[model samples]
Target: MHAHFYAIVNQHAGNYRGYKIWQQIQEYMIQKDVRLSVLLSAYPGAPEDLAYDLASSLPDKESDVVVLAFGGDGTLHEVLNGLIEAKRHFPLPLAYIPAGSGNDFARGAGLKSASHWKQGLLDLLQTTHAQVINIGSYQLQENQPRRFFMNSFGIGFDGSVLKRANQSSYKNLLNHVGLGAISYLIAAVFTIFQTKGFPAKIHGLDLTKSYAKAYLMIVTNHPYFGGGIKVAPDAKLHESNLKFVLFQRHHLGQIIFDMLAIIFGGFQYHMKAVDNTLLTHDFTIEVNSGQTAQVDGKSIDQENYRVHFSKSSYPFWLPETINKKR
Candidate 1:
């Protein structure tokens, strides 16, 4: 039986690689006799709009329906949130093609670049295997709309770094040449000097704590962050809990050293300066006003927020071949 494949391509991702990859995937799908429909995301929230429309229009046939996101983690993040918001009773397996800077989701899932992505995706569609992963949801204030994330969320230092990188002119060019991770490092150097710790309170899982100078807090659903840095080595996608890595105020020299250590896989040596906490089910973090936050690489304006995490309602399709090797 032929399958229905919906491809949401982010044209601006990966320095113009999205269009080329989409064309290649289209040719391959046509040759395999699969029914394919393509949608190009023209702006920031376009994927969410496309995903909502596609989910609402799903046919009642017995054939399979797959949604493929072609972009970075942020693109997939938007698509996943849209799917959840659609509130469809039927299952829709989601696929991703990495075409953005800092494709951490792809990296953690053992997926490679588009060198052989066509064949890999074809294999994924042919297999019946799908992985049910956890999703992170957050609301900045009371009665506000909630947002979901699949990778990780950051407040303070990391958020500031992402904000800087987004404003930098070299990010796209660096991504084009396979040096996207360097962009984060460059931004970190500048952000670290300017970033200051803010007052915050954490209440969750039978524990309560307050910090006067919380430099950064990273809540992770997966192990990788900041372009392949293993911030939480024990994190797994199937886990129901979230891993929190809090970096407190430290000397500039120590902060720089730890940053380099994370990049070089020496984070274990700097454990004394960082606090690692595991949160089950839900938590609330109250931060001082005017602090920035980020979810899945997109900046958010968060002052006080509550985080609730649980397994996704549906399964995410991953390349079985890649999963086996990992």
Candidate 2:
């Protein structure tokens, strides 16, 4: 276990739930006499800046240092990007605490904490070894720098939902009422009528084909997305393979069934799989038409681009009590 901690916290996330959780954690750390350095992010990209400068200034031989991120998947996403952008030769051990409404990454990564964080938090802080697991990486264009995502990638319908949800006034209202995750569902309902879907060309994966109207293209490294929904039931984080789940729309009736099933409950159980889903080592997706995109629940502004997906391993400072066997 690492003695020193570099914690990047977002106090305003999840309607100040991040701040509330931090209070509990801070008291625990003090009681245990653990050395903690707290950095609070005030705005959107603050965590990335804080993490980038921190990693850039750190020594290469510090085996006892762990950078702890205390926020949502998006915060973790920024922190990991910052560390990678620093161009360090050695990987910095990471520890994460889920403070967002839809902590799908935490669930997908087999983390012991989510709803029951009190005991789970203590277990992780006292964990013996850092758990090594596979993470995702992608590139938007040929010359563009590679970026990382923790959970899954989405394009078209789901991306539009996330993009809208992030900016919607009702989202804040829902958060105030402790229904923050339902924001995605509400946004998706709006997008369903506004969006007509888009076409895409698939390549690199063994079974490549053209998609007429890809209502949803979610390439997952694990089983969870949009809170606890198992969009890709067979996808596992420990494994190196990425599962591609695509939903094609033939008509309004077909897509209403496909998209609604995905939001309310698990999609895999409702639909029969034939050519819609594929699994491989890696794949390249090209969308010629304009559409929205999202990585790990955060919106990407780019439209009409090529993206490639692959996997790499990172050591997350987590408890061994996590289903290590999985």
TM-score each candidate. 0.92, 0.91
> Candidate 2 lDDT, tens digit per residue, 250-317?
77766667655665666545565214454556778888777788888898767486898777777788
Report the C-alpha lDDT of model 1 over 1-326, residue by residue, as the tens digit.
34577888898887786567768877988887878888999898999999988887876433477888888889999999887777776757788878778888887677766656766676666756566767678766666677788888888888888888887888878977767777887898898788776777788668788888788888888788777777777777767777888877767887777677677774643477787888775787777657778889988875555544433435777765754323
Q: Which ten residues in a row have the lowest lDDT in candidate 2?
A: 267-276
Off by over 4 Å in 2: 112-115, 205-207, 263-279
- What RMSD, rounded to one decimal, does every model reach? 2.3, 2.2
